[model samples]
Target: MNLETDLGGIKLADPVVMASGTFGYGFGYEGLIGPGDVGAIITKATTREPWAGNPPPRIAETPCGMLNAIGLENPGVEVFLSEYLPRLRKSGAVVIVNIAGRTFEEYVELASMIGTAKGVRGIELNISCPNVDMGGMQLGTSPDMVYKIVDSVKQVTHLPVMPKLSPNVTDIVEIAKAAESAGADAISMINTVQGMAVDIETKRPILGNVFGGLSGPAIKPIALRMVYQVYQAVDVPILGGGGIMSAKDAIEFLLVGAKAVSVGTGTFINPRLAMEIKAGIEDYMARHGHTGLHEIIGAAIL
Candidate 1:
């Protein structure tokens, strides 16, 4: 039952964590998986101010995946701290706040705020969000920008910083290395692939934003490949995501060197998916006579 893992200095009871955005704030899914059941609760992407998000048709179903343009509609950092943080502290889970900022100073400010917050475990920088108007795609796609953003936030906070990477990049390895060199404690990646859907009948785009990022089974292979390449390029821990619906999905990430696996679109399909994946991983380790999850990290390459 050694599912425990480490993300820099933060230790987790397991390698399964709920991905930001998909899990909403920490309070919504507590009924399905207790705060302690999974390794960590990565909250929704919060901005410096409240966002109304995009108009209707924010989400649309795809074959094996889904596209969304939720636009990071959050209650703002002040509201989150004044309201959400108090309830999250009691959930019995490690609170990892996922934050996005329009500029370098904003990110630094957000990180510093979270560092002083009592219940926060770490900060997962949501640098890959394409649906937002600010620094999501703008900062994540370029290695230099990624480095600069990570550097700015690292200077302000002592808490572990996990820079989430975008899949819509020419070279993920390059971005991963940039984040590592810029002082990122860990890197979470393959946020979403840029995509669009159209309604044949109306002869119009499906989502309000016209283009949304894709998630779910369709992007798993791409996510794994990025994580594997990133693992080879840097020594920092990697949090791999993008379509992990089952334990087998999670194992694929571990085998490729992900320190932990984050559940995204899968939670929409099954709220208890993280718990099921955790149990499945345990069952797998027992049957194979492998006693710990760490043993599987990068094992496939060996």
Candidate 2:
């Protein structure tokens, strides 16, 4: 079966992508996955300036998943260009640079910067960050904000602009529609559900941030539902992901109209998770006699 897929204009060797922040710019997985092991590697979130991330106790184990408020920690886009992106290209991995910024201008700046880089296949805008200029509202929570950010970034770069949608909203479909209207090349759905965990011992929050994004098996159903809804509403390709721990989970996302799947928390348990997910997808296709992803993508929607 043909697993090759196109996310925006970026062609992926397979449908499985190494989600951002899970691989840390693809350097940690050189020993685990060789060249072309996965479709694409989304680098950790890059900002205009280096971020120290949240305070300690940023990650905590939950019932069937995990909670994390890493706060988009990274060494800044300058370092990524001088170091990480080059090494990722040499490793033969298709790279999608995920970028975040403090203000609207910062987002555009990062887009222009990465667009000039050598091997970046596409750009995933991290809109889940607080809009400090807008009174700390998440840029993704407001449909207008989503449209504004995507529309502005699209003007600065020729690279594919994909806004990663946040789940912490009243209506995710509206947010996605706004992105599409703003000329987003593609859409990345369900950027972790808002959640928190408290310690009965200290009678305080387990994470220093008090709240974190939830991931793992616990959110897969919610992710799938949201992806299905957004797929029906938008015409652009969808990169669906959240708590996908196995091939079946990834397949579920495909059936619901996700053109591709991004594996994040699952990778933390197994560094080579993308390769295994790819192999499992190939196996499923052969067993089911499906010729290509088109047969599986959105097949269950009807």
TM-scores, all models, native as reference: 0.96, 0.98
lDDT of 1 by residue, 1-302 (tens): 79889987678998899999887775665466788888998999888878888987999999999999988899999999999889889777888999988777778888988889998989999886432444345679888888988998998888999999988888888999999999999999878888999999999999999989899999999999888888888999988989999999999999999989999999989989999999999999999889887788998764
Which stretches of model 1 miss by more than 4 angstroms? 129-137
Candidate 2, residues 138-216, lDDT tens digits: the string is: 9999999999999999999999989999988889899999999999999987788899999999999899899999988
TM-score of 2: 0.98
Candidate 1: C-alpha lDDT: 0.88
lDDT, candidates in the order shown? 0.88, 0.91
Instruction: Choose the strongest candidate by TM-score.
Output: 2
